[model samples]
Target: MHLPSRPDLTKSVFGPQSDFIAVVFSPVLAEWDEGAFCMPLLDLLVARGYQVHVYDSLSLAQESSTLHATSENWDAYLRANYPQIDLAVGQAYGGALVNSLLSGFLKTCPRVLGLSAPTRCSAELQSNLASILTCLDMQGETAALDLLEYYVKPERNDKYQPLPPTKVEESGIGQRLRIGFSQLMKADARSHVNNYAGHMLQIYGAASRLVNTDSIVVSSDNRRQISSGISGCGMRPVIEAPEIALRLISDFLD
Candidate 1:
């Protein structure tokens, strides 16, 4: 499939702003549903005097024709365009993507804010993440299907709660369908845990250790795997994700 030209986000939504923040949303995992996960953050950022750029990972993946884009492509996009993004933020799958982008694309930005970023994304450093991806992708097709049934379908009709009622009004037929399936087939949480866990753990661990202002970590009420002692290494408790997400980005952008 031919990828659409990069949407004219800056001109169409942000007006003409030299310095702005990019608010990339996470791949809506199947069980969690859509609109429920991302819209709250958009509201918070808009209230902050920041021009937020929202990228649906699902839409980009379909157009890009890849379940996921590696950090290299993300970096190249930044270097080639939108390099002026002063700060980048996201959560869960989205968090992983932004971290990957910054790992490759960061130039002068002072901070990157991440919510519920799995330590496994830096697995090479965090030995605990060794099995992360395998656990997720072992049953790839089924997992994908589960995602579709839960989030994508509901998004189509605005049947899911926790989303603002206004959501039904804003999302058109096409976008709802596009968002639903994109979330389903693009990538699995486990696979993401595998590919980037080690790298992410090391990166965030280093940032924490170094007290780097360029990176910060926050998580929804989702508790880490206490048994394994990998605090912050599992699915974010779905309920708290939206609020925690908003706070992290707001502070980072401000």
Candidate 2:
């Protein structure tokens, strides 16, 4: 089914000197901006002539907001909000949504880059996510984030370092995190990944047990769809080492 042609994106998303349009589907965190990937990547993209827009669902998901979470509905959301997508970048949870949209509705998009996207949530991921949710229920927001960092960030040989929570906000943040995490664990975009016709580059950490890419086979027939893993970078290569991620992205998009 062809989506009806729509008007240009809102003026707020336009850049005066930009040559291309790009949108980032941000991950599931209230403090997503604090992550190393946020600014560094955006700056790099802007340097490459991309007018970038970041759509962080959690940021707008107040009790009264209408933004949905699951992969099934994001294509409709994008069609309604931002119809002209030149480049689509999804980070983690956002990646799953991007994959889904690309294969089914937004396949005409030129290129997509997935940073540690959870396109295939394994049993291990589900368990870890459930534990994090439980921690949120019992220990509170900061503790839950602490648990999340432990699970998501690991060094070479899959070793984890103790990192403090980036934000210390009211308990209301917990509800948003809970909703996002639930959707993260449930996201599976393998079918979308297989069917996507656009150019794709999906990167993950070498030792990430959270997102199993074993079953995600990007066929050589579609030379555009490629998947790579960064050794010693853990699950979040974008955060652990933004330079490496940036270089890889630049190389791919160029």
Candidate 3:
């Protein structure tokens, strides 16, 4: 099965005329070819009249470490790019990035949505992730992918095929992976979520082994949570079942 060529992250934009803007961040390990993982949600947001911006977080981190360093930098970057953002949506590690900025960066208190995002990272989780990176570095891409699959246990979806394999040595991908995981390990979304004074929607898959769903909670007046019991619907509920994910997100955004 041939997969679509990954879209260039820097050139992709959908829903040009909508007043509302949404920025999506891709998962850590999938950053090299983010479009494969993020396109489903991006297309859905565009169809729903939202001007969406999809970013390759690993790439951005490589370009500038300060982008995620503080709330000030995050606020400046968003305000400079878009006149306003109605909502912010993130997946997995990307969700952690969004969560880190919500409390201090977004002044307008836009609604926040997180899909299979972890609120905290334990020492064990960090060590396990580090081991995956080591596998990628010492062994090869195949070994890394295998270890990651075992750890994340992502659901298999026919609609979305796996991204084409790439070498860790290509385009300094190994370094970027290291940086991304480091950021993820340090991310603590609980304080940010607790401090955020806006509506929130969190969705998780019942079979997700990557993120602890119980640690995620919404304190806003308007809060919704969904736990899909679909078989093999792991951390990537969006990719495993885009239709259901879109419907739930669209309904919540409306």
Pick by TM-score: which candidate is best? 2
**Alpha-carbon RMSD, candidate 2:** 5.0
Clashes of each: 16, 0, 0
Q: What's each prediction's TM-score?
A: 0.46, 0.79, 0.78
- Per-residue lDDT tens digits of candidate 2, residues 125-171? 78888988877777678778777877777633544443354444556
lDDT of 3 by residue, 21-118 (tens): 78776677643464567677788788888887766655345433533563344555665556667877777777777777776545355677788766
Q: Which portions of model 2 miss their true places by more than 4 Å?
A: 1-19, 32-36, 59-69, 81-83, 155-170, 212-221
RMSD in Å for all candidates: 11.9, 5.0, 7.3
Error (Å) of candidate 1 at residue 35 is 6.3
Local accuracy by lDDT, each model: 0.39, 0.68, 0.64
Residue-level error in angstroms, candidate 2, position 230: 0.5
How well does candidate 3 score on lDDT at residue 138? 73
Q: Candidates sorted by TM-score, descending order?
A: 2, 3, 1
Reference-based lDDT, residue 219, model 2: 47
The model with the greatest lDDT is: 2
